[model samples]
Structures are given as C-alpha cells and as structure tokens.
Target: MKKNIFLVLMGILSVVSHVCAQSLPQETSQSIGIIEFVLKNSKYEDTKCDIHSCQMKSKDGGVSLTLTHATMKQDKEEDLHYLLKINVQGTLFSTKVEVRYRNDPSKQTMKTGKRSDEVDSSYKTEHRVLRSWIQFIKDSTTSKS
Candidate 1:
C-alpha cells in the first residue's frame, strides 16, 4: 500500500511540474526580430557606430543595447527601471532616460549633463543632452525618388 501511495504522489508531482512549465512566461521571437532590425538600420550622423551588440534573448526578460562606449539595459517586464552609460567623443555622461510605453505612443528621453574629458580622451568635452526615440513608421504610400 505504501508503494502504491508513493507512485501516486510522484505522478501528481510530475503533472504539476508540467503545468507550471507551460504557464511560465516566455520571450517571443518577434520582439528579438524587431530589435535586430532597428539596430541594423540605425545610423549616426558623421560619427560611425561601431562595436554594436544586443542581448534580446536574456533569460530574465531583460534586453541590453550597446554601441561603442555606450550601454543601456532595461527590463520593463521584470522591473520598471533603466540604466544608461554613454561616452561621446572624449566625454562621459551617465544618466537615466525616462522610458514609457503605453497607448501606442512610446517615448524615451534623458536629462542634460555636463560632459567631461574622462569619458573619452580623444576629443574635447562639453555639456550635452542626448535624446532618442523609436517609432514604427508605416509605409503608407511610396513614390519614385
């Protein structure tokens, strides 16, 4: 009778585990694809964007965005917090950019800060503010250029 009871308990445990696994949150492939597309198509004016790296497949549902001496990582689903570190020219400015995603209008912006030469030792530094936004532009109508 004890052996039968043990087998029954094991079966119940296995079933519960399977159910939990099925209900666990999973990152969709579409999100990764969108990020890759944007990164590949992004361009910086005269300055070249090098050493591009992305971590959209994070286990904790966090995504990392980096370019050269700049890095930004955020996990809105897990925690409503973001961290940004950027080094432009010869100046280093680190600040948090407010991120909002809702009602079909998503926006992100960073406050101004005085730049320093320690950020990058190759060029002059000055106070500068950087703002970036991403929007889905629908190809409504196309004409020959």
Candidate 2:
C-alpha cells in the first residue's frame, strides 16, 4: 500500500513539474520598438502625415503605409500578425500594398481578403507588392539608428 501511495505521489509530482516547466510569456517592449522603427524606415513616401483612416502614407518614398488593426493570435507559438496597407505612389500613378507579418517575418504568407472601396485605394493594386514590403522590412535592421 505504501508503495502504491508513493508511486501515485510521484506521478502527481511529475505532472506538476511538467506543467510548471511550460514556457512563460516572453514578449517585450523591444519588439514593439523594432516594429515601430521598421515601419518608420520602410522607405514609403509621406512618412510624416497621420491620415488615420481612408488615406495612409509612409515617410519613405517607396510605399504608402497604414495600420488598420492588430491582435495577438492564440497559438502555441509566440507570434503576431499585423494588418498593413501600403500604396506605391508615383508622380502620376500608384499601386496597392496589402500583407501581414507573422512573428515579424514577412516571408510568412497570410490570408488576405478583397479590397473594399472603403479601404484605402492604394491597397487594391497587386499581391506582388507584399514581397517588396517584406524586402524593405528585412533590410530595415541595417538602417536602424
């Protein structure tokens, strides 16, 4: 009987330890800072104006930028995806930029929906622009101040 109790107690302890071994939340403010920095230096035009809704622009001259909404996805992995809209504007023309970044890497593909007239017209252009945005993000670390 004592042996059985010991085994049971050991099992309980093992389970408790296992549960306790689970990773804790590792998020930090630094990541947010990196994101902000990246967005600022993304090389899109109009890097200064805060248009809030409808109109969006990045300070860089390469792509227009706007952040619609953001949320933390519930998953085993520590990750987040941001809904971003980009507009490649020029002297007389413009294109759309729409994509999401998972865990800060733009290479990760995300499911994007059709553009609405209510949404920024710049975000309605082409899917290929996502790659450009990703490229800009990947190169961002080098230009950090």
Candidate 3:
C-alpha cells in the first residue's frame, strides 16, 4: 500500500539522520588550573561569576559571553540576537572546551555604510570574536607551564 511504502521510507530516513548526527568536538588541555587562572586574570570585563561558570562582556558591549557548550547553527531570522554558548569542563589535570552559537554568527555580516547592502567584514562579527576569545583562553592556559 502507498501508506506502508511512505512509512518505510520515513523510518529509513530517520535512522540515517540519527546515525549521522554527532555532538560538537571539544578542545582539550592538560593543564587544569590554567583555565581558572586565565579566567581570573582576564582583561575583559567580568559581568558575572560563580563556582563553575561565568559571564563576561566587552567594554564596548559589542560581544558578550557566558561560559558553557556545541556548534553554531543559523536561525531563520539573521537580524535577531542569539546566544553563543561556550562550555568548559575541567578535571584534576585536564580541561575540555566546546563552543556553540545558536544563531550562526558566521552568516551574520557587518554593515559598513548607510546602505543596507553595504557590508564591511566578518572580522567584527560575533563568530570571529568568539573564536578569538576561545583562542586567547587556550593560548593563555596552555602557554603557562
């Protein structure tokens, strides 16, 4: 029957999609205390903090971060604000980090001029800034022996 055939195809598609799904990759480091130390000594303005997590924002308020997890996924509306998640899990001797921007920041461009279509660069985009912040933390954490 047509209904039976459709059901079978749908089931197969679901199985394939599930099998292909994967969690975002995390960056690991051998130093455990470095993450906390770097965070405490960070140059950025500390908006909030607690035992396991912290929220930081730039002085200009152009970029904000709440330490947390995953990968970036774009939304239907690009103009709306989005939450960028960066997760850090630490153990006695090591740490792991994963960043996720709910609304893909890479797709969001910056306007250069008064014209709507006029765009400058992605350097100032949310994604770039997030990546920079992650790299800074990693560099600062790992570089210290």
lDDT of 1 by residue, 37-78 (tens): 443354322222224421121222232333222224434342
lDDT of 2 by residue, 1-145 (tens): 9999999999999989986654222231232233344555554433332322223345646455555334434222434354566555555544553545445442333322343312112232222344344455434423441
Say which candidate scores most in lDDT: 2
Q: Supply candidate 3's per-residue lDDT for 26.
A: 24
What are the per-residue Cα lDDT tens digits for candidate 3 across 66-116? 643322223444342333343333333322333433333454222212211
Off by over 4 Å in 3: 1-43, 69-132, 135-145
All candidates' TM-scores? 0.20, 0.30, 0.24
- What are the runs in model 1 whose C-alpha is more than 4 Å off? 1-29, 41-145
Clashing pairs in 1: 90-120, 92-119
- Give the candidates in order of lDDT, highest first: 2, 3, 1
- Clashing residue pairs in candidate 2 are 44-60, 44-61, 44-63, 45-60, 45-61, 46-58, 47-58, 47-59, 96-122
Q: What is the Å distance of residue 86 in model 1 from its true position?
A: 13
Mark the 10 consecutive residues where model 1 has the least summed lDDT. Answer: 136-145
Error of 2 at 138 (Å): 3.6
How far does residue 29 in candidate 1 sit from its true spot (Å)? 5.7
Residue 92 of model 2 has an lDDT of: 51
